[model samples]
Target chain A: MEIYRYSMYPLGLKKLIVPCRQLQAFLQDLLESTDHLKAVLVTDKDGVILAKATGPDLPDHVLEPAFSATFSVASDQSGKLGFGRNKMIMSTFDEDQVVQFNYSPLILTLLASSKANSGVLIAAGKDLEEPIKIVGESVSKAIQHEHKAKEYV
Target chain B: MLKPKVITQVLQQANTAGVHAALLLNPDGSLVSFAGGTEKDAKVLAAVASNVWFGYERYGKPPAANSVEGGEGKEGLRNLILDCEQGKLSITRTSRMLLCLVADERVEWGLLKAKTRTLKEYLEGPLNLVASY
Candidate 1:
């Protein structure tokens, strides 16, 4: 599948909500706070990368869609196990760890070294709750505006 | 093969420290030993852990990236933590087995992880013995 890379101005939301540049800055700040973090991605529910920041140590093949989609499925399935809603999923490998937050309408993913503290990353994801909700709401409004504009044409 | 008494002891030890249940399973999801839960619950957890692990392997694969050399890169998931409304679920790999801890809301993340790390270390020895057998 061909993935579409959007500019800092995404979804005709250029002037409507938080600009993509600001979103990128937010992600960059997260990357800078952690020493072992390699990359951070902010993607919509469909796995479209809205903003991203990368450190020098990132691997060549960090597929944005894979992380987004995997979290979606994993979280959805796991929720039915009587645990109620799934808030976060953290996977650790030998050399790397992936942490994803189940922020609806938006998924925040972090790529970090295996040695990085999971608790810190979990706290970071919690801290993102409000900002992500605001961004999600703004984008939804912008999308509604776009649909309305198309109807007149 | 691990003696039943040793497996029971391992599960018993894990039952402390706010861990409500503990399970030891093969990589294939077959339950080997379990504690603090019914047999049916153990089976269900084993299946869930296997499915979640497979989901990560199938969908979390990086695109066109070479495997990590001489590492367990091909071994799929090493550890997974699921934070939910009621509690936390931690699954860690040990040798060729998987150690799963089901903790209630009272369990803190640090305490749970520390318990998991210690259990993983302890399991390694018996697991190697089983492998040798």
Candidate 2:
């Protein structure tokens, strides 16, 4: 299929939110495909971790709380550059290249080794770009779903 | 507190070599010293780059950018070269400080890389002393 979709019901909400099973699965597939991938983190605009995958060799400490807070600060502060909105930030390290893709309220981080195919890594994110946007919308639906459930209860 | 003169010296040297700006930043994205660009611009760069650095440093051993060989070791991070659309930004480190260089589009990357190492060595002595205190 050219397009993929999956359904998720956030907590108590009856209305199915944006299809994220595919996103989560895709994230997993991404981790599995890249041998040197350290981790993958998906965060809301506030830097809340929605989902994550830890690679074979890397420790979870790499995605510690500090990273979320840093993302929050960066999103809040980076808008002033007058460059519209920063869609992504790529930082090159001697050992690896860290790429963060911004899909509005959601950000996807891919950690790959320096030896890994840069083009392939970039493609992974590009292929999922639309899915990330769907993830963001789903998160909002989940939030509203919780709110509605609270009101009814 | 870092001696501010170190930044001026770095800027002077970088400027002579045709680099646009030079600055020192803490890993936490705090500004230590900057030689070029507006204050706001430098601060933003510090914040973003440090966030990237913070995430990258904790991934265990970084591969030595041994060109394309991707040699592995747990040396943390040694340097970063960001070749952006407009220009290039290079970061090298002392034991306790991060040196950032914003190069013009036509700047000599090889010389800038070498200069960054020298700057790191220069800052290491004073920064390490403070670290021990």
> What's the TM-score of each model vs. the native?
0.81, 0.57
Report the C-alpha lDDT of model 2 over B1-133, residue by residue, as the tens digit.
6568865775657765567778788877899888877899888888766765555465423343332333334445666554443565667777676788777546655676777788788778878877564
Query: What CAPRI grade goes to candidate 1?
Result: acceptable
lDDT against the true structure, per candidate, is: 0.77, 0.65
Query: How would you encode candidate 2's per-residue C-alpha lDDT over A51-146 as one tens digit per residue?
Result: 777666565444543444444444444444333454555555666766667676777877777677655766787788887887777677767767
lDDT of candidate model 1 versus the reference = 0.77
Error of 1 at B27 (Å): 2.7
Model 2: residues with Cα > 4 Å off, grouped in runs: A1-18, A45-66, A80-84, A89-97, A117-123, A148-153, B1-20, B25-33, B39-92, B102-133
lDDT of candidate 1 at residue B5, scale 0 to 100: 75
Where does candidate 1 stray beyond 4 Å?
A1-19, A57-60, A142-153, B61-76, B131-133
lDDT of 1 by residue, A13-75 (tens): 765455656777787898898867777887876788877888865554555337788888888
| Residue A141 shift from truth in candidate 2, angstroms | 2.7
Error (Å) of candidate 1 at residue B37 is 2.2
Per-candidate clashes, comma-separated = 0, 1
Q: Would you list the clashing residue pairs of candidate 2?
A: A95-B63
Candidate 1: true interface contacts recovered: 0.64
Best by TM-score: 1
Fraction of true contacts kept, per model? 0.64, 0.10
